[model samples]
Target: MGFLQPNLPQLDLESWRRGTRNERMRPLVAHLCEVGFGTPDVVYLFYVVKIGLYLLGAMAFAVATAGVDGLFSVGDWWSEPIVFQKLVLWTMLFEVLGLGCGFGPLNLRFLPPLGSFLYWLRPGTIRLPPSPALVPGTGGRMQGTVRGPVDVVLYAALLGTLLVALLADGTRSSGDLPGAAGLLPVWLVALPLVLLGVIGLRDKTVFLAARSEVYAAIAVTFLFSGVDMVVGAKLVMLVIWWGAAVSKLNGHFPFVVQAMMSNSPVWRWRRLKHRFHRSFPDDLRPSGLSRALAHGGTAVELSVPLVLVVSSGGWVTAVAATVMIAFHLNIISSIPMGVPLEWNVFMILAILVLFVDKAAYGVGDLSGEGVLVLAVPIGSAVLVVLGNLYPERISFLPGMRYYAGNWDTTVWCFTPSGLDKFDAGTVKAAMLPHQQLERIYGEAEAEVPLFTGYAFRAMHTHGRAHFALVPRACGESHDDDYLVLDGELVAGVVLGWNFGDGHLHDERLVAALQERCGFEPGELRVIVLDAQPIHRPTQSYRLVDAATGELERGTVLVADMVVRQPWDTDLPITVTPAPQVEC
Candidate 1:
């Protein structure tokens, strides 16, 4: 790939024009392993610039806090507990503003580059309530989906609350350590935490936008004073590390490494990139090298955090922190699809501050109410437990399943009928995904960029399974009848942004769209694939149409998908037909 241009595969342009969708995949998916989605070098630079803006914005927020004043002199006050607390709030605010994880061309946001604040602040947009029966003031007149005035208030209030907290001064000078800076009052930090919880119950889209799993945990720590707060934060990070490591125990994570490296701007060597695949153009299944790296990294994530916490201020702690720092830096350099750049940088800071600087303050230092602070990590662990067991109900983020190649995924299959309805019926902030891609790459050559998005997905283990089942979801003549897309893309078009949580675009979401678009039976079809449960070998799936309800329900063996190529659309399935609808 050139610094200014995309190095696309050598293909017969006329042959591609004549080939069917399945036929096109043969070359496209292969090219994905070697050349990636053929994204231009300039686009990666665009993300690098965005990362700077996000960091500068965060530091500005922290600097506004009365006690903190380290712009050019970060080394002077970087270790202050107050600085740590303020940055946590700023990160939550950053993500909530749609500038964090799912922002820019990396996550497929091309036109305006983000949809969070735009979609949430507006009235009459779509909103998905977690449960209308349990939560009053939810489920609008339009089949429990429309965003009424109440929805707008809840979202805006959360943003306003976060801003108020970010700009507020510290409550008092810290007693935890001599000369430590003042910390944000417990109430100020708690206020946004409460609002985020309320907003989450109202709309998971806004909730996930904040990247609450990681940020909320840090926010919880701010409520505690002194040593207890930092130790509690360390434990919370531990759970996150453990959960991510355990999730990688499956046959999926290698796919993540290969795909991540394939698209990475830092990894310009194509031969080294091909090394992750079995034989590159022929057998694109993960090579031994990919698995070794995936599992080896998993071992590091699991063991290092424990050592970082258990080892009191010493070389052991420093070594553990160094290992973890290198781990996060490696990931950040890859500039993975989700573009969780800020989070990685924060983790590096966390290792330095919480684990290394405060290494002497262990959980043993907890006194009185500080012991109760243990509940934060305990609660996070329980969520991870439930997430792994019941992935369909819980998002991978909350389950602590960060980038382990396991995800609840969906494939949106649409004909012109459904597309027309979706285009006309929904109230959205951004243009349709294909439209945005075309606007960026031109209508004639948009497929190169569009399929690049799919390449990223198929690099994951579940994505291969999702594509294999697309035929069954769209029907036998799916290739000719429907244009298949990752549910995340469609979610971005309709919901404004998607951070890889399929629940945002699952059957429940389809029900919401069905209420508005009123699709005919053949118009819209969705294939919802749940993340593989930790205890189960197979992942369950559902096929649904917008007009009708479920069309089929079944399971696809993980064994079948792990071995197939990215474009292999035929994996044998264990299945049961849905109750047929009458004309």
Candidate 2:
């Protein structure tokens, strides 16, 4: 890949278009092993620039604290408890602003380059309520998904409260060292907590975008006192690491490592990228090397944190901290798809302060607040366990499975009429992926990036099964009649922000879209795949048409998907048979 231009694949689009769906995927998936997405180095540099700004902004927020100094002198106040607390809040604020996770070309957001504040602060964009029938104000005969003036105000209020807290001076409650700045004011900490929860009741999209899972938990930690507060935050971080590690213990993760490593600019060697797959260009299943890296990383995630958290400070703590710092830095270098660069940077800083600087504040230092001591970890543990056991009911984020390949995901197939209706009928911040791609890469050459995205999805285990099932979703013309797109991209367009969570674009979002755009039977067809239950070998799936509702439901064996090539989509189906479609 060049500095400014992408390395387009050498293929005849006219002839490639004439092949079968499986046939069409052959060369594109092959191109992935050699060229990956062929993304230019400039795009990755763009994300690096954003990361620098995030850190620069964090420094600005930290120095705003009265006692926190060392704007240029790193050693003076870098270890301050209040500084760590402020940066945590800063990361959350950055994410919720829609500038963090799913921003820029990598996430396919071009014209506006972001979705959160642009859509959330506006009054008429779509919103997804956590519940409809039960939450009193969330649903009505006509106002279930519309983001009215009230929604806008609540979103604005949440941002305002967080800013206020970030700017507030730290106070020394019963929870500080002799000369140390205290934690954030308890009321300030609790206000955004309440607002996020309240706003979540109205729109889960905002709640998840703000990353209520990690940030809100840390916010709650600020409400505790002294050792209790520090201990609470440590437990929250531990759960995040452990939960993500545990969730990766599946047949799916190697596939994730394969695709992510391929797209990464750091791994510029094409042969090295090819090795992640079973055989370069032909077989795209995770190779043995990919499996080894995936497993080794999982072990580090699972074990190193225990040492970091329990080691009462010494050379042992130093070693563990180094390992974790390296772990996060590698992820940062990868510049993975969602571009969660700032979150990883925050983790590295967090490792320095929480584990190294404050290493002595482990469990042994808790200030006899036994109730809070038990509650935070216990609450976090339950979410992780339940998220794995029943993924459909809970989002993967709250379930603590962010980086794991296992996530509730979807594929949307839009008819030409369906695409037009969607483009015209919805109030969205970004244009459709095809429209944006056409403008950026030109209409003739857009297919490379488009199918590269498909190859990226197909590299995942669910992508294997999801594609195999697409012929069923489209009923007849897999080529002539449908334009297949990733549901996450669609969610970004219509819902404003989606961080690779399928729950954002599942049946709930489909129903909302039908309500707004009113598609005919086959105009908008979707394949909804839930993450595999931890104890179950099979994953459940649903096929829904925007107008007709659920037409089929079934389970695909995880074993079947893990063994296939990226372009290989044939698989046996069980439970519901043929889709209910009219010729």
Candidate 3:
């Protein structure tokens, strides 16, 4: 790949457009398998620099908070309880501000290159309520108005409250532990939580964008005192790692590893990328190497934290900490597409702060809270179970299944006019998917990046399944009448930011779009695929028309997806067409 330019596929536009779906996807798939995203070295370097800046900014926050003296002096202050708490707050601020996860070209974001705070802080921006029917005082003008002054103020207040809390000096503790000198005031921590939760009720966008599910839970632990605070933080990390690991015990995970490793810039050789797949075209399941990496990584995630939490300042603690740090570093070095660089960095810092440095704060160190100690992990475990069983009900973030390949995914097939209607209809921060491509590559050349996106989606197992099922989902609609885009791209346009979750664009989002755009039955067709359950080989899928409603619901076996090449769209689907429901 060129330093400034992406390697583009050499294809005759007229012939490519007229070709069969698989015919069009074939060249792109070969290109991707060999070149990955074909992302330029310059772009990768840019993200690396951004990662450096993020770490420096966190260190600066730590120093400014009087938690550390110098950047290199982490050895001296790394264990400070308040420092860790402020780091969590600081990371949350960074993410909510649109600079953390799902930022820039890697996530197919351009123009503004981000959408979280940009969308949330603006009045008249769209906000998706999780459940408008169930929540009282949630309907009427408050439901989906142009974000009024109050919404903007509330979002700004959440940001401001978080900043103030990060800057606030924690009260000195009457403890003997070396790092347990100060604690964030309960009210200071609680204020942002309440504000975030309240704003989230109105805008699930802000909630998911802030990653309130992960960071907010950690922030709540800051409200506790003494050993409870330490134990609470430890439990939260355990949930994150354990939950993610547990979620990986499935048929879909190997596919994720194969795709992720193929996309890894660190693994530059095409041969290495090819090895992850079973073969070129016929047998495209994840290779043995991919499965080993997937399962081994899962084991590390599941086992290391347990060893870290239990080992009380011995060589065992040292080895576990090293493994955990290396684990996160490996992920960071891979430079995954979502560019969750800062999140991985934060996890590394967390290992040092909570596990290695605060090693003594185990279950035996628990203070007044006995039963409550088990509640957080147990509750998180239950969510993981429910999340896996019925993924439609929970966001993947809360489900804690980070990068385990399996995720709720959707594909929206839109007519050209339908795309225009969406642009005219929705109150959004970013341009439509095609529009963003146009801005970056120019109107004349936009289709290049546009189809490159399709290829990227096809690299994943769900992409193959979703697109393969689209014809059946949309009925016998003419191919030229619509364009296919990942639901994350649609979510980016509608919800501000999407970190690879289809829940953002499921039936709920369909209704929201229909309410605004009034799309005709053929204008917009969506397929929502749920993450696969651990014990089951099949994953559930739902099809809905933007104008009409549910059209089909079904299951696609994992075996069908992994066996096909990236360009292949002939996956066997088991459909249960639903009676047409009105919007």
Candidate 4:
């Protein structure tokens, strides 16, 4: 009956679903479309194009330098002139002229107009020209303007001409005859162009134009010099290689060849074994049997080039090779990471070869012999080491101390062993005995006053008590334990007793008071609280009176009172209650 009683009408489910059909379907479709593919690959492709261009430029230069005729030359190619070489020679000449005259004045004439065009084209890349300002004058103000296109072009032209001139000169002097002839005309044209460029660099508007030109010339000259040095060094190396080969076939003793061969690994190892065995450490066996396999490999690598240098009979080539080897060795030694000790050994070996060649053969004149002579100190050092290991019974005069007078005169004094004669009487007086009278009196006294105090009123009302009288109990307490007198803190005066061998003094407490409490030594107030019994078996305290408002030794006690101990245990007596008692 209950289940049937609450029956209600059911609504249609299809009506509610139909009302929101578009809204539910829209978001589901949007999320499915949003998930995209991989990232863009344009950046990697751009870098590849840039690198290819740079490589292409370098290849072009190399091909231009090495003539096409040389590249294609066969066995009997001595007679023909190279067309490509001639073309390159002419091209360089035109480049020199263009730099000196065309670019030089042209740069000045078009710089402003060109810059304005470029700024418009690439608005974000270029900066606008600055506005001119007026300078105050007695008569009127004068306006200053920036350097225009003409001035800038003239400066660039001068720099270009200088570079061309330097390159031409280097090629003529250092290159082969054909190459020299090719570059000579360009060099000649550059000289006149340089002069013309300088003349064209006129800046009538600027007051400091002359100074600017001078600085520019100096800077360009230095830049040219650096370029020349690099080119010259390369040329020299090439020439030396050619000369060494020629000298070897001629059957002459090439000193350069010998030096190079000596620097080579194989020759160095062979000689190091034969001649430098005793000089190097014994662990590095010269006999080859005890040596590592790597040493033999290094020897083989060095030997081949060295043999060529020696056979070549070019002494200069040999020396250059040796220098190269030394440089390489130095580089190895200077590496920031890995195998530093091994590299150091290599450097030392190279140096040893140089020294031996200079010493034994005197190959480069008597200069080598002079170096060997100066190396006597090295031998002496070895001898000093040997001397230390072995003992010798030897004696020398004892060192003496002398006193000098005002006029640079020396006065001799007796040695330390003769001190007995100098102060014999003072020594005897110190040794003279005295009876223990104080101890005897202390024991004989019917009553020993254990408590003694000494105090001093401040010298100047605000100033310190000039002196302090210390009590024996003061040293036993901590630094914070102190006796205050007349409302002023006083802890500077204390017993000089040192626990654990008299090392701990009251100086630390005094210093603490001066620094932390802002009390100078002259501002100190002291009260000596002596804990001794007063006319009884019980412990008592006393406060001593000051003499001339200063607390010092022998100041008499002013007040005495016996106080019962709170506890019978061996605890330190309280000096706190002692200060409270009126004197």
Best by TM-score: 2
The segments of candidate 1 whose C-alpha lies over 4 angstroms from its true place after superposition are: 577-583
Instruction: Report the lDDT of model 2 for residue 568.
Output: 77
User: Sort by lDDT, best first: what order?
Assistant: 2, 1, 3, 4
* Stretches of candidate 4 exceeding 4 Å from the true structure: 1-41, 44-48, 58-145, 155-583
The sequence of per-residue lDDT tens digits that candidate 3 reaches over residues 1-583 is: 7888887778888878777665677777767766777788898898889888887777777776644577778777777778888889989999998898999888878777888877877777667777777764446653463466777899899889988887777675725456534777789989999998887777777888888767888887766666777787788888889989988887778877877787787888877788887886545667999999999999999999999888888899999999999999999988888888899899898888888777877887777654365666667778887887777788898888788788989888888888888989888867876887787778867876777677767777787887788788766664566788888888887778889877788877887788788898778988889988777888898888888887888899988887777777678888876578899
Residue 78 accuracy (lDDT) in model 1: 77
TM-score of each: 0.96, 0.97, 0.94, 0.18
Candidate 3 is scored at a TM of 0.94
Instruction: Give the per-residue lDDT digits (tens) of candidate 1, residues 1-583.
Output: 6677777777666777676565676677777777776778888788778778867876787678676677767777778787788778878888888888888877778778898888887887887778877887675476567777877887788788888887887776666753355887888888889888988878878888888988998789778877788889999999989988988888888888887777777777789888988998888888989889998999999898999889997789878988999999999888888788888988888888888888888888997888988999999999999999999888888898888878988999989778888889888778877788788668977776666566666667777777777777776787778878888888987887787889899987898888888899889999888999999999898888888888888998898888887777778888877568999
* Clash-forming residue pairs, model 2: 175-226
TM-score ranking, best first:
2, 1, 3, 4
Which structure is stronger by TM-score: 2 or 3?
2
Candidate 1: pairs in clash: none
Cα RMSD of predicted structure 1:
2.2
448 Cα displacement, candidate 1 (Å): 2.8
How well does candidate 1 score on lDDT at residue 460?
72
